[model samples]
Target: MKIALLSYSTKPRGGVVHTLALAEALAAAGEDVTVWTLGRGGDSGFFRPVDPAVRQEIVPFPDVRGEAVGPRILRSIDTLRAAFDPAGYDVVHAQDCISANAVSRCVRTVHHVDHFTTPELIACHERAIREPFAHVCVSAAVADELRQGWGIRADVIPNGVDSQRFELAAQDVPGLSRWRSRLGRYVLSVGGIEPRKGTLDLLEAFALLRKSEPEMRLVIAGGETLFDYRDYRTRFDARAAELGVEPVVLGPVHHDELPTLVAAASVFAFPSNKEGFGLAAMEALAAGVPVVTRDLPVLREVFGTVARFATEPAGFAAQLRAACADPGSRQAAGRDLAAGYSWDRAAARHVVLYRGLLG
Candidate 1:
């Protein structure tokens, strides 16, 4: 079967990571899979190397300075729509709002629903949810959201983790030494300083956390996005200064070094207000690291047994303290939990869905 999996950017955002991994897994399962994406920032390929079996279509997406977010979103839709042809593929799956809007017919994986205020964005978000031929969500909670909010039924397919890679990184003495030497005993968070990420909350939590354990540091990594959040970033910087906490902001860590970075952390923080599935937390789990995430239904569904959930900054601070002091049994349990969510399993389920739709 010929399959085309579409996503908005080649950056290492959660959805793009899902897109590439799913494409490779589908190809591994003997399906002809092609990954179509807008190569934002003049990039020509994915953040990391993909298997050669799967075809790639990276449409050039150059940046326009001072372009407003609304106009940029519209242009993204227009550019991708003009370049993408949906004739040959048996299944066309859009992995994000932009890609979903670009295609008229598709199975959209609504990773997470956003409450947009802008007119164009609000319309785009609405159409992306309403117009898809079918829908898939990574968790039952998100699926329930689709049913309740949009009256749409969506299939639930959980994301898969690269468990072996992360697990092995935990054992790499030299690599762990490198990260440990650079950033000693840190609480690591991926997904940059954005409002939804609750980075300010994390900063507050880290500040409170530091009161007790002054030796441990707060480190944030991996922030690649199509949207501009300069205002949020400005707020984050000001707040960090106000809190008097210096967080090591290592933007966009390399794919090769990520596993080791995840493993070397004293704790992994995921204080997001919204999430479909916490893939980064899952990867940290795969690395045998303890996770502390915001208490949300979707997070509870995915990480209930494997992680520590917190309500607010104080809760997060407390949980971080506990996780670092005694990570407890969550380490072993987390790795096992992550190991269960295999990309092969996710791919097989996707294949079944595609076959059912095609038949």
Candidate 2:
């Protein structure tokens, strides 16, 4: 089957990572898959490198503007492109909320919701999630939010990672010792510097933890934020300096190197206020690193009994301390849980969904 994916902002973030993994998996399973996106920096920065098998077609358009032409009109233009060229593909999958609204009726459609927290985005998403396209939610919590808040029914398909790549290595790298020495032995947090991700809360928790475990260090990995919030990285660094604790900030590590980063951690710290599905937490679990996340429904569902849940920063710090104290049991439990998921299994499920939609 020939499939086309519509990605409005296909950047190197969680959602884009999920999309590419799924696309690659689908191609490996013998489906011809291609990605249609507004090229680099057109809408949102397109940072991810595309797979060789998965074709990428950048839509021909200038930089997106303010509400002068309006988003609806821009969406209509994207829809026109799909409608005009409906010859090659049997199905079109839209990975973006707004872009899904414009797919042609000739092609079977699928829409995956990575995360939808705002009411305005939800309302806009509702228009795209019509009868022809099957709606897929990254987590049950996300699905419930769509139903309860937006009344949009969707199939729950958790976001998947390439487990093999993230698996624990038999031998550690020669440079790992130096890397760890520089990073220190504290809890690790990896994600963009954003307020919604609870980076500030993580720093606060780390500060609280340092009082007891003075040697503990908190390492953050990711780039600076575009949105004006608390300047999470800055705030975190300042707080660490104020407390006289070691805080390591390693800007965005490569996808291939993520396993090393996770494996080196004493414990993986995720204090996000919300998530569609905690992909980073899953990666940590896949790497046999125990997780400490907020008591959110999506995270609870993903981690199950394999992680430590905390509601506040103090509790988070306590959990981190406990997790660090018992690394062997935590790693063992995480490894066992991660064994349940593989890229091939996730690919097979996507194939089934696509075939069912065609039938």
TM-score per prediction, in order, is 0.99, 0.82
Q: Write the per-residue lDDT of candidate 2 for residues 61-169, one digit (tens) a residue.
A: 4544443324544554455465436577887777655456556452222322434455655555556655335777777877787678657677776666655566743
The residue-by-residue lDDT of candidate 1 on 119-230, one tens digit each, is 9999999999999999999999999999999899999999999999999999999999999999999999999988889999999999999999999999999888777889
Residue runs of model 1 more than 4 Å from their true location after superposition: none
Query: Backbone clashes in each candidate structure, one number apiece?
Result: 0, 1
Candidate 2 is scored at a TM of 0.82
Question: Which residue pairs come into collision in candidate 1?
Answer: none
- By TM-score, who's the top model here? 1
lDDT for position 11 in model 2: 48
Full-model lDDT for every candidate: 0.94, 0.69
In model 2, the Cα lDDT at residue 89 comes to 87
